[model samples]
Target: MGSGLPRSIRFDERVSERLTSYVARHPGWSGSSAANRFVDEALRMEDHPGVIFRDGPADRRAVLVGGPDVREVIRSVKSARASEPDLDAGMVVSLVSTNAGVPARLIDTAIRYWAAYPDEIDVWIDEVESFEEQSLLAWERRQDLLAR
Candidate 1:
């Protein structure tokens, strides 16, 4: 008997082993579940993507806020960063205003919210097979009493 599903893809042994390891690491998961989760995440990432720059000039905020002097915000952010390496929305807004020539205040507000509320993404499908086993055992006991 077959599920009658067409098999267009194949998984290599190495990939299968890695997926099994991932399932073992995660609580309440199986190897097949891990494989499905990985594919789903990969497809989602491909659908929406951003560019990764290498040593490019910063200023991502100008697009968000309209400003006459974008460079000023960039300068402010750069100056602030000199004292602090760890950056927040304020620094990014300043840089964007400088590069994109947007309003500093508008970008600043947007950045604050974006920084404060980040998205958490997790994927898994779980089933309680143990409960099914218990139910089957109870049903067999009831049938045994009825047979008498």
Candidate 2:
């Protein structure tokens, strides 16, 4: 989690009760922790309209509403930017949007989210790359075993 300033706020009785209930349902989460995560995700979603958080095997991550995960979008944009050195940022986004068949807004939204939480997205990217490398190596081992 990024270093965010802690602010104290008083919730109504009803909201407090709901937070308690949510904590009860989700083990290993305290009321304060749940509330903080909820508020953070709410703020991010409000700031980025097209971004949504989804749960995966690894963890919850920001993803486009009607497209792939934000990590994928950001990675695609990075690749595009690297390959098309002559293209401007806007043009690269447009090209990625066109090729991905998603609206330019979603692409922009992913970039915006990344700007807001670079550390979170970078961790996600690293985890995925590690997983991909592990899978490939396992597959190669299997192929070698079959050859033997």
- Top candidate, metric TM-score: 2
| CA lDDT of each prediction against the hidden true structure | 0.46, 0.89
Question: Candidate 1, which ten residues in sequence have the lowest lDDT sum?
Answer: 119-128
Give per-residue CA lDDT, model 1, range 76-131, as digits (tens): 45455675677775666566666656666655543333333223100000112355
Given candidate 1, what's the lDDT at residue 64?
Answer: 25
Clashing pairs counted in every model: 11, 0
Query: How much does candidate 1 score in TM-score?
Result: 0.31
- Write the residue-wise lDDT of candidate 2 on 1-148 in tens digits: 3456777889999999999998899888887788888888889899999888888887888989999999999988988988999999889999999988878999999999999889989888888899999999999999999994
**TM-score for each prediction?**
0.31, 0.86
Question: Candidate 2 — number of clashing residue pairs?
Answer: 0
Instruction: Compute the lDDT for candidate 1.
Output: 0.46
Candidate 2 global CA lDDT score: 0.89
Candidate 1 local Cα displacement, residue 18, angstroms: 0.5
CA deviation > 4 Å runs, candidate 1: 1-9, 51-148
Q: Residue 65: error of model 2 in Å?
A: 2.4
